[model samples]
Target: GKQITHNLKSRASEFIFYALALDESTDMAGTAQLAIFIKGVDVHKIKKKTETLAALYPLKDTTKLQDLLEAVT
Candidate 1:
């Protein structure tokens, strides 16, 4: 993209990723996840990404994040 390709490439190189599964949803959905590998994903970036995704996909109620994770598993 004519966008921030440099920054994107730099960030992309920072961590390796592995596709976890094809799809986790019971019904047809495009939602998927990536198992972030490599190292150096320090707390700051983790917090930032968590907060970013949390804002993007806010949990409507207290469904226990761990349980939601279990559902995916």
Candidate 2:
């Protein structure tokens, strides 16, 4: 168990990738519709976008998966 724990700790800083894309349209105001495209993204970006989206768009549970799935579908 101790060895496994140590190994996991060593890999904790491993880099990961993710993807986020948002396509939207708006008129009149400069910031009406927003489209975000995140390809080969990372965890840091995910957390940042999530917080911003939660504050701006108000998504329940403050989770990014739901939003990501919505974009895919």
Candidate 3:
């Protein structure tokens, strides 16, 4: 897991431009979860890469915009 994080950070540092994707969902227990992904192109090879940056389970009950924002920040 640490290696994967390192690789993602290494690639991200070289990104020319990037975009983020956020997914919010509720589990069977009604717990809200947020998943964040990043997509970008590298500066050197112009290679495109996509990676999952985080999966956050906010302590709050709902997955509203405010809740998501709080989870991330």
Candidate 4:
């Protein structure tokens, strides 16, 4: 986990510009799951790349917009 995180950080640092995408969904157990993705253009190769930044699970009964913001920050 630590190594993967380090690699992600290293790759993200080389991005010329990046965009973030967030998706919220419910699982079979009715738990809210938030998926975060990063889409970036490589500075050196000018190639576009997309990667999963994180998957956040809210511990609350309902997953509110504020809850998602708080989990990310």
Best-fitting candidate, scored by TM-score? 4
RMSD of 1: 12.3
- Candidate 3 vs candidate 4, lDDT winner: 4
The root-mean-square deviation over C-alpha atoms between each candidate and the true structure, in angstroms, is: 12.3, 14.6, 4.7, 4.1
lDDT per residue (tens digit) for residues 1-73 in model 3: 3543555467568788777677887778877777667778768767656455644444477777887777666
Rank candidates by lDDT, best first.
4, 3, 2, 1
Error of 1 at 1 (Å): 5.3
TM-score against native, each model: 0.23, 0.22, 0.62, 0.65
Pairs with steric clashes in candidate 2: 20-38, 22-35, 22-36
Question: Each model's C-alpha lDDT?
Answer: 0.31, 0.37, 0.66, 0.67
- Candidate 4: residue 17 lDDT (0-100): 83
Backbone collisions counted per model? 0, 3, 0, 0
The residue ranges of model 4 lying beyond 4 angstroms of the native Cα positions read 1-11, 51-53
Provide the lDDT at 45 for model 1: 56
Ordered from best to worst TM-score, the candidate numbers read 4, 3, 1, 2
Better candidate by lDDT, 2 or 3:
3
Per-residue lDDT of model 1, residues 42-61, tens digit only: 34455332101111122223
List model 2 lDDT by residue over 1-73, tens digit each. Answer: 3443343333333325533345454445443333443344234554432211211222223235665344333
Which segments of model 3 are wrong by more than 4 Å?
Answer: 1-11
Per-residue lDDT of candidate 4, residues 1-73 (tens digit) = 3543454467678788876677888888888877666678878878656565644444456678777766665
